[model samples]
Target: MVSLTERTRQGWLPLFVLAVGMSMIIIDATIVNVAVPAILADLRLSATDVEWINSIYSLMFAALLIPLGRTGDVRGRRRMFVLGLVVFLAASALAAASVSGPMLIGARVIQGVGAAMVVPMTLATINAVYTGSRRVIAFAVWGSVIGGMAAVGPLLGGWLVTDHGWRWAFWVNLPIGLLVLAGATRVPETRDPSAGGHDVPGVLLSTVGTSSLVFSLIESQRYGWGGSSPVPYAFALAVLALTGLVLVERSRARRGRPVMLDLSLFSISSFRYGGAAATVVALGEFGMILVLPLFLQTAIGFTAFQTGLIIASLAAGAFLSGGIVPRLAKLMPARRIVQLGLLCEAAGAAAIGLVVSPGLGPWTFVPWLALYGLGVGFASAQLTSVMLAQVPSRQSGQASGLQSTMRQVGAAIGVAALGGVLVTGLGGAMERHLPDRPDLARAVRDSAGAAIAGIREPATRAAAVEASAEATRRVSLVTGAVLLAGVGAALLLPDTGGRRREEE
Candidate 1:
């Protein structure tokens, strides 16, 4: 058997294969959103069941990333990559054939595990195979795919659900998976020669810490943060687990055993700040993605298709910026470019907040969203290159895993924190504006869609719409503020002039 390294000297084929596999994972993250209503109706799923179906994949995926990434480093990246593809492909098939909600959720959990294995390897492999300028280009393409696919997911899901039904969303992964598998054969196998025996305690601690933390964040929106809700308990458990992980990893290092996370990586200023900026970027990006559709549909009366099309403008901007940033890197430092992107995002979000209203047209928000997307494209395209540049090639797998873990945690928090803001704002608006009818106001506060549908009086409907519009406006502003914070974090990154040579 020809080795993957010897077969493809230029490395484009392997890169393309990695991109395709990654696209599957990134697309799956948001593709299910547009199909949820259809799935619920077809499968007779309760609201809780539907929520779990949506949340469980991410929960499992985030939890297993560090452990699996370490496994790939200890074993072989290519081998784990192939195994991940197999698991993902099988789970996709099971999900497509699912007869009940529980079956689908189960399949999704397995799918998340596969995705966890596949994601870190893509970047680690690129870090290994590409050198200098080519390495910079490789990471640019990787980042572009991530940003572009996330934006495309909802549009693609809407089209698939509208035309071929919800099952095709999962089914579409089959051919792509096969193509990736075939190409995987040509990808070089790489691993850490110095990697020691796995620390089982380290794995358990990291898994529990991340999963519990993510679960608490995700569930806090549904189950209020106070009282007997599991949010506080889960959060406390997360803190305990994470602290334990730190102690255990330090012990493992002292004992000369492999640990899941290299706490030492945090010592690098670029890695530390770059990871922080990535998290903040994700918080703004994912929060906006979640809240925009709600505002468009509930406050502005756009259909799902119409909402998706408007959202596509964001993707369009991201694609345009993604293409431009690699060249821009030639002219400016990566840190400055990231700061510029965050500025665009902040400005765009602020613009949206100012302009969003019940009377606003659907097309009115497109330009602002596009600007925000452009920011995402620029930041995402270079941040990975900026951060991973600091890590030695041998440690690329663990670094990539940590990078991904930060982004996931950011996303989960973005949704929960920004989502909570929207909910609270809406309730507050309704309470303040609808003082005459407390019951109706409470109903509207509880469910925006139900409020829109149930309120028959024109005055009441108008008040509810205004309340929703206000809530959305506030959320947009908050999202902008979050991105602005990312700007400050981006400044901490060493001003490496966008030269791949300099990064190396």
Candidate 2:
């Protein structure tokens, strides 16, 4: 067995390029979140429309990731990677230039398509390119970059939105994209010699099924829950599609044809457990990304930039942990390390619940958030390394795709479920306290979400809005508690910690 060491000068550059492109994608994911209000104001969009703008990108990306990952394995990881970057760059430009809400959203869907292509292939490429200690380092660095950018995206967006306007935030990607494109051209191609061509039916089933499931979850918040028409019907269709997808994959596996996601991949205990852990971890992390900034800006009355600064603590913690986890992977058993990571996350969340108060300054969020990030960093790096480590080299793409899909699915569901909790909790709290006053109640109900931005009654709006803010703060604290519980679940993951095997 040959080792895929990262000693070559040429190899490092492309990996760095891969990191940059990934940063662009992750940054864009959260960057638009903080500036959503600015987008809503500029485009005169509705809440549903805004949700689509966000959901479309994730839906398409998550839906297509598996198929694209398989395509990268069969065709060429490098080819798919560059192609994805091109599409993403083009879509970013289109998104930036949009004249209307729908146009921008259409562009975002395309951006999601492109992101779907890029993100999975990047991981496949890394798996192909590095081995041994170097492979561990590469994943650690990649994890840090991802965590760092996610943490900083809001601050970056806030500054860009506040200083140069929101368009500049998307525009910022253009130059970076072009540079990565150029750099990517110089990298060595990673091709799996035994990999087969694209699995068309598998692609259709997986993409359709994933999109349906995501759409159903996103719509659940809007519809009043009783009807079998939209929500129930959509969910039913999603289940059927996913069931059919499983059948299709099984058929392919039986016939000896490669499928987009190989069910056999999950037979590896380490891979299965690690992948599941990764999915849950993503749910907690990405969901927090959606909620935390809103908490800071809406509840604590922090400016976007100030909120960004506080969120930066998350990245700092991740950065600090990213560097430390790989060495820890070398030190402790994998299960113990994962357990420790989970404990750290729980502690961090509990700290946030205890310390995060409306009257507390932005600086107060820093330590708790950093602690959370540290746990996130440890789990993230080890999780990816462990999951991919168990996969056969030929099927690495499938493993990467499956893990990425799970992560994104977790993210989508997390935002929908947890965001729902925050919104509904706040609304219920407001209704309970202020429902007797019709005008004030109407104003509270009209606020659209946990944010009181749309409320109109000036005389009573202030007090009512304050109540809403407090409610949202309480909800956030609850969310933190729930997330901590999730961290506790990480204790059951398999012990796979050690030096990377020379054969892997």
lDDT of each: 0.79, 0.73
Strongest candidate by lDDT: 1
Question: What is the per-residue lDDT of model 1 for residues 1-504, given as tens digits with 9 covering 90 to 100?
Answer: 334356448558778778878988877756666565567557866434544565567667777888888888888888999999999999999999999988998998999889989988888888878877777778788777766776787788767767788898798788878988998887878786666577788888877887787678657756878988999999999999999999989888787777888888897778899999999988787766766765666566665567777888887788788779867877888888888988999999999999988899868989998998898888886888788777777678888898988887777667666766776787788888888877876665545333465567888888888888898899899998999999999989996553332333
Point out where model 2 deviates above 4 Å: 1-11, 354-357, 437-451, 454-459, 474-478, 481-489, 499-504
Per-residue CA lDDT of model 2 for 64-120, tens digit only, reads 888888777777887898999989989998988898988998999899889988898
Highest TM-score: give the candidate number: 2
- TM-scores vs. true structure, each candidate: 0.89, 0.91
How well does candidate 1 score on lDDT at residue 342? 89
